[model samples]
Structures are given as C-alpha cells and as structure tokens.
Target: MTGDNAVNIGSPQPPQKADVLARVCAALSAGDADTAKAIIDTDYPMVIGTKAQRRYTLTETLRTFYRDGFLDRYSGTQLIHPGALRTLSMLLPKEFPAHLNGKMTETHFAQWELFPTIDHVDPVARGGADDASNWVTTSMLRNSAKAHWTLSELGWTLHPPGDARHWDGLSSWFTGYLTDRPDLASSSGYLRRWLRATRVVQAERA
Candidate 1:
C-alpha cells in the first residue's frame, strides 16, 4: 500500500495493534460484526501490565478513544471504526519540550508535579499536525479544555492559542495526524467541518 493509505508506525514494528488493523478492516469492509468481535476478543488482551494490572478491556479502551476525540470516526460517545482507530499516538518525552524551548531562560508551570502532555495548537479536528511544530506543552486540564476545539473556535486569549503567529507557523509546517493514519482520514467528519469553516473565512475575507 502507498504511504497515504496506511499509518506507518515505524519499522521493527511491534505486535497487537498492527495485527488487528488488517483483520478489523476486512470485517468492517464486509459488514461482519461477528468476525470483528472475534478479532478484538483475541487480539487485544482484556488486561495489561506485567504485575497483573487490571487495565482497560478492548471494549473499554475503544470507548475511551472515541469519547476523548482521539479517533476521527465516533458514534455519540463510542468508536465506530475500531480498525481505523487502531492505537493512540506514541507519547512524547517529558523533557523534550524544555529542550526544544531551551533558548528561553524562564519556564512556566501552572501545576506542580503535573506531567506534560502534547496538545495540538490548531487541533486535529480543525487541521493540525502531530509533530513538534504543531505541538505545545500542556497540563491535563489545559489539554482537556482544548479537546478537539480550535483556538479561534473557543476565543481563547492565552499562551499559544492567543498567539496568531504561532498558529500560522504551525499551519505552514502542517501535516495532519490523519495524514499518517489514513484509516481515520477516510471516516473523519472533521474534514467537512474544516472545509465549511474555511469557506466562511474565505467569504469574510473576500
């Protein structure tokens, strides 16, 4: 398959998620829920952790991804395209942001002991990348507040969202997360929303 058609999760690939992607795709394409159910049951372990941690079951994990706006295709508060949704993006390093912003002599932290999470300035729902340029350091509260909403859409006037110039730079350096995850792209209703927004902006500018 071409690079545009599938998510390339880097070679020396791991198992689990990759193995299920193919099976789920076939089931969905053929409208076979029975096959899909069987695939998920066998593919994703109901529990995780070496020390017998009772984490999310596959169903639970899928539900979370959909609820959290991670997947492009969601049904109310649940995932529709389990195959396309696949897995969450790889986590970034905690110190990586500090290192990237190293030129700054000062750093700000709103919450003590709160780990940094990667957040998109433009938002994937409104067209944004998943890489360094489009990413910003954020706490869980900030990230949750910013969930799937664009800076302009929310009328926020602080930090990266407040800075129009930063968003412009990110737009120029753009590569949407969906570019890598084509499965999500195929079902992303976000594209239509983005297009409508774009047309309105263009019309206003004109």
Candidate 2:
C-alpha cells in the first residue's frame, strides 16, 4: 500500500496464489465462517437474478462478445465458472479439506483463484456512478481487496479490457460443461435462468 500522493507503482500486481491460499487457510483454521463466507461471495459471486431476464441475456451476450474471454481487469488473471464457486461455498468449512491443496488444483482455481466478479472502477462509496462505464470485470479476490479504494490509492493501473478473440473466459468449456451436466442447471435456479436466457443469445449469435 502507498500514500495517496505516492509516485506511480505501475500496474497493481495481484497477490501470489500462495498468499491468497494462506489467507483462506488462516480464516478456516480460526473457524471464521463469516470471514470465509465473505471470501467466497466476493471471489465467486452467486447469481441472484437481479437483472430482468432480457437484461441478463444481453449481459451474457456482451460477456461472450466476439467470443472474448474473461480476465480480471486489475490482476489480469483468467477467471472460471461462477456456478462452481457457488457449489464450493455451499460445501465449505465441513468439507473444506477435500478442496484445499498444496498445488493449485481445479477446485482451488474455481473457488478462489479464477472466479469472475464485476468491480466498480471508482468507489461507489466515494460517489462513483453506478453504470457500465464505471465498471470493469475483475476477480473476486481483487474486488474484495479494492473495496471502496481508488485506483490511485491502491497504486493500481487499469489494464486494457479483454478481447474475446483471444480469451473466451473458458466459455466454450462452460458450454460443454452444461452439455455434460445438464442436471446441474435443473437443480440451480440461477443456472437454469442463465441457461434459458443465454440460449436465446447463443442461438442469435449462431
């Protein structure tokens, strides 16, 4: 962290994956459910169907715009399935060990490392407007770390937005996952609604 008037620290580098894991380890070791839940929700957001159905479909389409992949605007880390994050959060504390690992495993990736989140470029608390122009896609970890802080205060630079031509945020993988695990959506209203809405967009794009 630097002073408000500190010289440029260049772009903000994301904390090492090890550091993130260590933090989670500490929280779980202390049996801090609230802290852990905060981490889970911040990192892997669960859909709440806040957007109108048509709006949600449009949002998904923009996400898949040009088949662009997702990247954390602050850390530039690739993100994975939000649905998986929800599942991991549900299975946590009691089932924590099965997911924890020394090496970065698939479970860790989805739960901690690469879960996508939307971030406000300016702090809403500080009068940043709540609109798309003020928003950027980021990982959950970065979002939590940046809560209400300005980019200057954090010594972070805004990375260029992701181009779907190069990275599709593993969307193709998600589509395939849906095909292989249709039952997942059947059980999750969030997933079911997303599937229903995106299907319309997917067809149009096809």
TM-score of each: 0.24, 0.55
lDDT of 1 by residue, 82-184 (tens): 2221111112324222222423333223221132334566665545554445555454445677787766657764341223222221221112444555564
lDDT of 2: 0.60
Best by lDDT: 2
Q: After superposition, how far is residue 77 of candidate 2 from its true place, in Å?
A: 1.1
Candidate 1 Cα errors over 4 Å, as ranges:
1-113, 158-206
In candidate 1, how many Å is residue 194 off? 36
Q: State the weakest 10-residue window (summed lDDT) of model 2.
A: 47-56
lDDT per residue, candidate 2, 11-41, as tens digits?
A: 7765665666667678999999688667655
lDDT of each: 0.41, 0.60
